[model samples]
Target chain A: MSEHHEKPEISPAARRFIIALCVLAAVLVALEFIIHRHAYFTTEGQPLFFAVYGFIAFIVVVAGGVGLRKLVMRDIDYYDQGERDE
Target chain B: MSSLVTLLQIPGLLLVFGAAVVPFLPHKLRQAYMLAIIALSAYWCWGIDVGTHLSTNLAGLDLTLVRAEAITRPFALVFHIAAALNVIYAMHEKSRLTATSGLAYAGAAIAALFAGDFITLFIYWELTAFTSVFLILVSGTPRSFAAAMRYLLMQVSSGVILLAGAVLLWHGGQGLSIQAMQANTLAGGLVLLAFGIKAAFPFLNGWLQDAYPEASVTGTVMLSAFTTKLAIYMLALCFAGTEILIYIGAVMTLFPVFFAVIENDLRRVLAFSLNNQLGFMVVGVGIGTELALNGTVAHAFAHIIYKALLFMSMGAVLYRTGTAKASELGGLWKKMPLTMIFCIIGAVSISSFPLFSGFVTKSLTIGSVAKDGYFVIWMILIFASAGVLEHSGIKIPYFAFFGHDRKFEVKEAPLNMLIAMGIAAGLCIVIGVAPHLLYGLLPYDVKYDVWEAGHVLGEMQLLIFAILAFVFLMVRGWYPPEIDSTVLNTDWFLRRALPRTVNALSRPFLAAWASAVAQSKTAILAVLHTGEETSRKSGLVSGVASTGAAAAIFLAIFALLLLLRFVA
Candidate 1:
């Protein structure tokens, strides 16, 4: 399946748009320092706490999911192989 | 709203009995009848006054069939609306069993919400499990049939545990009341466990992921709305502020995001995301503050709409393309642009984008968590919110619509599906923009504002950064590709490990039992033979004794005794 279709390459324009969006997001994170952020915890008062937290949390979740897939993923027929339909 | 109907006219019954009449109707009228039932029920939900409606004695206990309170009213409202929308969405479906059972399941869920006593709640609770199983089974595939069995068992087990808890509560002199309980007693803990199972708390959650995706497309949409939300309503009613729920809710919020990320099945991803969304409501229920409870109810209301929207879109995709696995789906936006748009709306709503329904509702819970000063939980919840963005926000839309082009052109979703999704998507936006439409329906007085600058900025930062992370991973090819594989969860115990263990355990046990039966059979035969021989010998002896020989012997002995006496 992978060999049948070439992976679609990101258009340069789309790439530029993505980069711009990332920069805009970075600017928002930077603006958080000046914004009067209501920090629930004292530690959360730091600049870009949510940005860093969101980034790391997503990575952790994705990484954790990858690890879990390695442990638990099986052939699609894993549960369906038997005729236990009584 | 209150002047239109008397208390005795329970809205839920209109749905329940109306569903009974569905199978009798001609195929053309079935859809219309279902729609009418939902409409009438919705009208009743709005009209019924906020008080106990019907009280009756059953088996020496009082059961209340309809009780409307501030909390129950909102849940009932959303349930009816969701049912109605689901009916409309499923209008094209011709399956009588699916239509009938779906309506019945919806009605049972509504009735369970209105139930003022544990007995009534229990009746409706188990009814939901029984009726909804038909929806799964009506798919008529062996996989769905098997999934339905597991789904039914898990659901019924929850109901049974609920009954046991109710009985214990009654024995403890609680008198069958359905109300908040302390977890110090056996009844309270059992009741919590029961609700937890339906609510898909952590390890007990596998059933939702296992069975829901396997349901028929329309059935999945109907299912996505009710069962768990019903349990959430029950939890809000019965186990508010139980403390342990706080931790459970936190864990519930976090774990599903991970599973959802790598999930190949789009519907299963939605299932995991559903679990994650329920976590927010659970946290609110755990907080048990008036604000938190209101948040929970309002969130459930919003979630039903948005989640159904998501499921309906995916259902459309599955209906058209014949597969919901992400591995087999991509670049569908070219043909199914309407569905893509709706899916994006759902994704945005669930992601808590600033102008979406989830923003208005989920923020309340996060705010309450922060206000209550549980810093760690508050942090975990924030993280989970971002995780929500990863799996539901990006993964759902990107893989299905915008990811690598699968070069498949399919027709747009059917008109009924688009209309249903349109209405749901409309509600998501309406509630997001004008939140008071939802806030006013909350169980408590509404004071919190969702558009506070700090909250808006913080949520935006979190969501945007999460998106950035996703883009980073995608561009770098670090993101996991969707595969045609099954990811294991707690269901492994019942579906895989337990079956194998049973097979392994039963073999030796069967052999030993066979040997034991053989030994017992030999011993029993020997005993029977001995008895037969002894009986034959005894029969001959008795036959001789009964005859003249015995009489002569007796006479001789008597004569001897008489002679001896005479001599003496």
Candidate 2:
């Protein structure tokens, strides 16, 4: 009973589905790297420019994480709260 | 004499007058009248050509209804589209109150667009405030009523300041022609404040978040289009390149993303996102270059459709499920596939994914800002742009349509609602695919292209990369779930804090009134007590004093006879 209040339980199938999505994303990103190596799918700058790219990517990822932590959300009764109680 | 042709330039005014009479019509005829007026308003706005300036002096000042090919045309055109879309959206809605108020709202905004002079503009400005509040009232909710009143007060107060500015302008010897005024004058400052209120300039933008979410679904769609856009149009015309709006726009753009992120209400999220979007236009308007102005016009056009689409989808969710919170809703895509698809399209458009309406239009504003060498503003805008993607792009559709649907089962949006959403979704794609369709309607000829390789790659990098981040969060189960009653932005300043502060400050004065009553009672009681004591003392002393006087008189009579004999 206390466990129910702790958090809604995530089903095993849903958890597997989420893992599969993650794997799929990683594979797609790796494919982009491979395809770019063959003189096709050129990037804005050289893909090997790790120092500059890594810094920029890190900032973006960190900023995105911060934003997700801060903003990216919805509420349970966002539409239906505080109404018709006159 | 040919200038008088400008009067015919906006036949939408007469149609507005007709719409005001629509509600009074017998029940069956009401909708038909509303539809006819909408059609007529559309015709007047789109059919009118690119040249006609009607100017006749009211009092030595040029009260020119000059139809210059500038901001008004595009603004008016969007108003026409919004009015028609709103009418179609409300087709199945039975509320006569919403119908009348919606039409009157559109009419008032259209009138403001064609307003020849400051006086005309101010009148229509207030009218927009007056008519739109009814849409909220018809919702029959106490919260809606309160929100509408706040919306009305703020909107009307903005109009009052505008009117005051016009009066000052007339007195200060600036001619009444609807052109740019210098920022130095009293009228100029007043007008800026008025426009600031309407434009949802940073601190003054509370009314939007307060009111828009509370209106009826169709009412919110109509609400999204007119009020803030009208202020932008006015600001574009009168205060272009004022320099201050640049920073103002940047702050407006960046500040709302935080609030929007934390916000629970789907409608209010859109409202915050709108403030952010308007900041882009304000930046462009402040830039005041031809391309920047074109960008502002084009963005407003695209934004109207996409924003309305987003609202429609959410409204449908609200209608069917009876709730729009992310926590309560999950796995709804199975039920509302069409709405989901339309919502995704709206999301893509707002996110400015390459080949969407937002991509084609919003880039011009950012690009122009960059070209103008406002590097700091440009960087802030880029950061804000990323924030926009985080909040509106991923969060909206993800939570509502895609995320853990919390296993709630609900029917798809009604056919009427779907049709409305479909129309909006169609417009979004059309604007994205054929940017010229929208760009052609712009006040200036825009040579800027949105599909250049550099532009496409940059946007793709930004949006796709952002999506990767969203995916990362969801996979980790680190995302914030929708909750109930998210705190509102700037509105807390006026809605919660201001009223509380005033009450606290006035408590002593309130107590003083009772104290005054107590003091008056004490004074009257003291007077009565004094009278009672004096009468009692008089009664007690009278008998003794009279008896003593009688005894003294007897003794004095004998003494006086003896003394008289001696003296003789």
The number of the candidate with the highest DockQ is 1
Please provide, for model 1 over B1-568, each residue's C-alpha lDDT reduced to its tens digit, 9 standing for 90 to 100. Answer: 4522433276676777778789899877887888877887888788767788778786789988788877877888889889888888888887889888999899889888888988888888999999899988988998899899999999999999999999999998988878778977899999989999999998899999999998999999999999999999989988788788889999999989888887899999999999998999999999999889988998999999999999999999999999898998888999999999999999999999989999999989988998899999998999899888988898988888978779886899989899999999999999999999888888788788778777788888888888888777766667877889888888888887887788888999899999999999999999998777756735644455556777888899999999999999
Residue-level lDDT of model 2, residues B382-403, one tens digit each, is 7777777877887788788766
What's the residue-level lDDT of B220 in candidate 2? 89
Score each candidate by Cα lDDT: 0.87, 0.76
List ranges where model 1 is wrong by over 4 Å. A1-8, A82-86, B1-8, B504-508, B517-568
All models, DockQ values? 0.49, 0.12
Deviating ranges (above 4 Å) for candidate 2: A1-86, B1-10, B24-29, B50-62, B65-68, B508-516, B534-568
After TM-score superposition, what is the CA distance of residue B367 in candidate 2 from its true location, in Å? Answer: 0.8
| Residues forming the 10-long window of minimal summed lDDT in candidate 2 chain B | B2-11
